[model samples]
Target: MAKYKAPLRDMRFVLNEVFEADKLWAAMPATQEVTPDLVDAILEEGAKVTENELFPLNRTGDEEGCQFSDGDVTTPAGFKDAYNLMAESGWMGLGGNPEMGGQGMPKMLTVLFEEMLYSANASFALYPALNSGAALCLDNHADEAMKEQLLPAMYEGRWLGTMCLTEPHSGTDLGLIRTKAEPNADGSYKVSGTKIFITGGEHDLCDNIIHLVLAKLPDAPAGSRGISLFMVPKFLINEDGSLGERNPAFCGSIEHKMGIKGSATCVMNFDGAQGWMIGEPNKGLACMFTMMNYERLSIGIQGLGLGEVAYQSAMDFAQERIQSRAPGGAKYPEKAADNILVHPDVRRMALNVRAFNEAGRAFASYVAMQLDTSKYHEDEATRKKAAALVALLTPVAKSYLTDRGLDCTITAQQIYGGQGYIREWGAEQYVRDARIAQIYEGTNGIQALDLMGRKVVSNNGEYLKLFAQDIQDFIESNSDNAAVQPYLEKLGASLETLMQVTGNVITRAKDNPAEVGAASQNYLDLFGLVTYAYLWARMVAVAAPKAEADTSGFYSAKVKVANYFFARILPEAAALAAQVNAGADTLMDLEEELFYGE
Candidate 1:
C-alpha cells in the first residue's frame, strides 16, 4: 500500500516563508481574512484529510475502477464515502464564490490543497475539481436566478459539476465544435450534442451533476466566435430548488481509458436538454476561459501530484529494498545487504525528481498568486496587470510543469527498477496516471502553441516582456546569495537565449507557416527549464542559511540538489535552443504518407 504524505513543509516554505503569502493576502482586502494561523491550520487539516481518506483508496480505486451501467457511473470502492466527506467538509468549495455558499479561499492556498487532492487520488480529485470549475462558470456568467438556484447546492456538495467542452470530432479545435443550442419560449435553450471525455460527467456522487456545456446558437456565426456556454444538469430542479425530473442529459457511454480509473469520463448525449444560456450568445467562449484557466492549472498540479507521489514511494522502496553491494563497499555489512540509496545513480534519480517537484510547486504557487491579485486586488491596474500575468503564465503552468512532471514520474519509477513496471508496487500506476496529464486539458502541444501564438506573438511580445522583466528583477535582487548565485547566472543566460530564439522563430514563421508549430513544444520546454531554475534558486536561498547547522543535514541537501540541478538540469536549456533552430523542416520535412501505414 502507498503511504501518501503531503509535502506540507515544502508547501509552507514556498508560500509563507519564501513568497510571504500572508503579506500578499493582506494586500487585498478580499484575502485579508487569511492569516498565518489560518493557513497553518488549513494545511494541517488538508494533509490529514488527504492521507487518511483518499490515499487508502488510490490503488484500490485504480484496480476496481468505475462501473458504467445504462447511463449511470459508479465509482470504485470508498469513492462514494470520499465524495461525501469532501462535500460535508467544504473542501470542494474553497475557490468557489462566497456569495454562493463557498468558502472563497484565496487561490494560492486552494492550489496547495489541489496538489494534495491530486497526490491523494488524481482520478478521484477530478470529481470535485470539475464541480468547482462548473460552479465558477455559473457564478461568473450565469444570471442571478441561476446563481441562486444552482450554486449553493453545488458549492455545498449536494450537487456536482462538469465542463462539457469536448466533442467526438472537436477536442482542442473548439472552433469546429458542432454542438447546437436552440432557443425556447421560457428563455431556456435546448442543447443537443455529444460531448466526449467529460470528466465527472455522469457520476452518482451527488443528487445532481451540473454541466457547463458549450454549444452554438441557431443564429450564431461560424467558428469559435459563434459558440455559447449553457448550464445543463443531469437531473433538473423543481420550482422550490429541489431535485425534479431527470434531465435529457444522458451518458451515451464511458471511455475505457489508459488510467485515472476512478474518474468517470463520460460521453454525454444531450438530447434537447433544457439548458439556460450563460453569458450572451456567441460569447460563451469568453465564459469558458475562466473555467479553462482554472482547470489548466488544476491539470498541471495533477502532473506535479503524480510526480511527488511517485518520488515518495520510490524513495521509500529504495531505502528498504536491499540489493547489490554498494559501489564504495557496505554501510550495512552485518545485514548481508546494502540499501539502494547507497548507490549514487539511484540517489541521483531520486534527487532529480525532488528538484523538479519542488520547483514545480513554487511555480504553480506563483501563478496562483497572480490569479489571486487578478481577482481580488483593490486597484484596477493591479488587477489587470495580474490578469495579464495569469494569461502569460497559464500555458507554462499547464504544459511545462506537466511535461516535467511526467519526466519526474518516469525517473522516479526507474528508481524502482523492475518493481516499478509491475502493478502491485503502485509506481507503474503513477506513471500511467501521469501520462494522461500531458494529453488532456488541451494537450501540452496545444498549450505550447497557445503560449507562442497568443501570449508571445499576438501582442508582439509585450506580455512576454513583462513576464521576463519580473524574472529578471527577481534574479537581480537575489544575485548576492552565494549558495544560489551560480544557479541564478545559469537561469539568466537561459532567459536571454530564450528571447533570441523566440524572435528567430517568430521571424521565420512570417515566411514559413509551419515554423511556429514545430518550434512550439521545444520553446515551451526551454522556457520551463529556466523558470524552474529561478524558483530552485529561490528555494536554495531560503533554505541554506536556516539549514546549515541542523543535525539532519536537511538544508545542505537543498544546496546539493540545487547544485545538481544547475549542473545537470539547466544545461538542457541550450539543447532545447538548438532544437528550436532546427525549425519547421525537422517537423514537416517528411511527406505526410510517411507517418501513416497503408
Candidate 2:
C-alpha cells in the first residue's frame, strides 16, 4: 500500500513564510476574513478528511473503476458516499462564489486542498475538479437569474457539472464541431449533438449533471466564429427550484482505459435537449476558455499530487526493504543487509522527486496568488499586471509540472526495482494515473506550443518580459544576502539564457513557422527550470537564516534540497536552451512522404 501524509508543514512554508499569504489575504477585501488560524484549521481538516475518506478508496476505486449499463453510470464503490460527505461538508464549493452559498476561499488556499484531494485519490478528484471548473465558467458568463437557479445547487453538489466541447471528429479543433442549437419558443434552445470524452457527464453520485456544451446557431458564421455555448441539464428545473422532467441529454456509454477509471468519461448524446445560451451567440470558445484555463491548472495539480504520493510511498519502501550495504560499509552491521536508504543512488532518486514536488507546490501557489490579485486587487494597474503574469505562467504550470510529474512517478517506481512493476505495491498505479494529466487538458506539447507561439512570439515577448523582470527584481533585491546570493546568481544566469532563447525563437519563427513548434517544448523546459530556480532562491532566503538553530530540521532540509536543485537540476536549462537554438531545419528538412509507412 502507498503511504501519504499531507506535507502541511511545507504547504505552510510556501503560503505563510514564502508568500506571506496571511498579509496578502488581509490586504484584499474579499479574502480579509481568511486568517492564519483559519487557514491552518482548513488545512488540518482537509488533510484528515482526504486521507481518511478518500485515500482508503484510491486502490479500490482503480480496481473497480466505473460501471455502465443502459443509460446510467455508477462510480466505483465508496465514491458516492465519499462524494456526498464532501458536498455536505461544503467542500465542493470551497472556492466558489460566496453569494452562491460557497465558502468562497481563495484559490491559493483551495489549491492546497486540491493537492491533498489529488494525492489521496486522482480518479476521485476528477469528479469535483470538473464541477469546480464548470461552476467557474457559469459564474463568469451566466446571467443573474441563471446564476441564482444553478450556481447554488452546483456549488452545494446537489447537481454536478461537466464541460462538453469535443465531438467524435473534433478534439482540439473546436472550429470543426457540428453540434447545432436551434431556437425554442421560450428563451431556451433545442440542442442536438454528440459529445465524447466528457468527464462526469453521467454519474449516480449526484441528482443531476449540468453540461456546458459548445454548439452552433442556425444563422451562425463559418468555423469557430459560429460556435456558441449552452447549458444543458440532465433534469430540467421547475419554477419552484425542483426537478421537473428529464432532459433529452443521455449518456450513450463510458470509456474504459489506462487510468482514472473511477471517473466516468462519457459519450453523451443530446437529442433536442432544452438548453440556454451563455455569453454571446458566437463567442463560446472564449467563454469555454474560462473553464479550460482553470482545468489546465487543476490538472497540473493532479500531477504534483501524484508525484508527492509516489515519492512518499517509495521512501516508505526504501526505509524497510533491505538490498545491499552502503558503498562505504553497512550502516546496520547486525542486519543481513542494509536498507536501500543507505545507497547513494537511492538517496539521489528520492531527492530528485522531492525537489520537484516541493518546488511544484510553491509554483502552483504562486500562480494562484496571482489569480487572487487579478480578481480582488483594488488597483487597476496591479490587477492587469497580475493577470498578465497569470497568462504567462498558466501554460508552464500545466506542461512542466505534469511533464516532471510523470518523470517523478516513474523514477519513484524505479526506486522499487522489480516490485514497482507489480500491481500489488501501488507505485504502478500512480504512473498510470499521472500519464493522463500530461495528455488531457491539452497535451503537454500543445501547452508548450501555446507558451512559445501564442504567449511569447505573438505578443512580441511582452509577457516574457513581465516574468523576466520579476525574476530580475528578486535577484537585485537579494544581491546583498550571501546565503542566497549564490543561488540567486545562478538563477539570474538561467533567466538570461531563457530570455535569449525566447528572442531567438521569436526571430526564427518569422522566417519559418515550423521553428515555433520545433523550439517550443525545449524553450518551455528551459523556462520552467529558470522559474523553479527563482522559487528555490526565494525559499532558501527564508530558510538559510534560521537553519542553524532549527530543531525540527524542516528549514535545514529546505536549504539542502534547494542546494541540490541548484547544483544538479538548474544546469538542464543550458542544454534545453541549446536545443531551442538548434532551429527548424533539423526537423522540417525531412521528406514527409518517405516516413509515411512504419
Please list the residue runs of candidate 2 whose C-alpha ends up more than 4 Å from where it truly belongs after superposition. none
lDDT, residue 243, candidate 2? 96
Residue pairs clashing, model 1: none
What is the clash count for each candidate, in the order shown?
0, 0
What overall lDDT goes with each candidate model?
A: 0.88, 0.94
Clashes (candidate 1): 0
Please provide TM-scores, in order, for all candidate models, with all chains considered together.
0.97, 0.99
Q: For model 1, what is the alpha-carbon lDDT of residue 560? A: 83
Tens-digit lDDT track of model 2 for 273-380: 999999999999999999999999999999999999999999999988998788998889999999998888888899999999999999999999999999998889
Alpha carbon lDDT of residue 517, candidate 1?
A: 86
Residue 494 of model 1 has an lDDT of 84
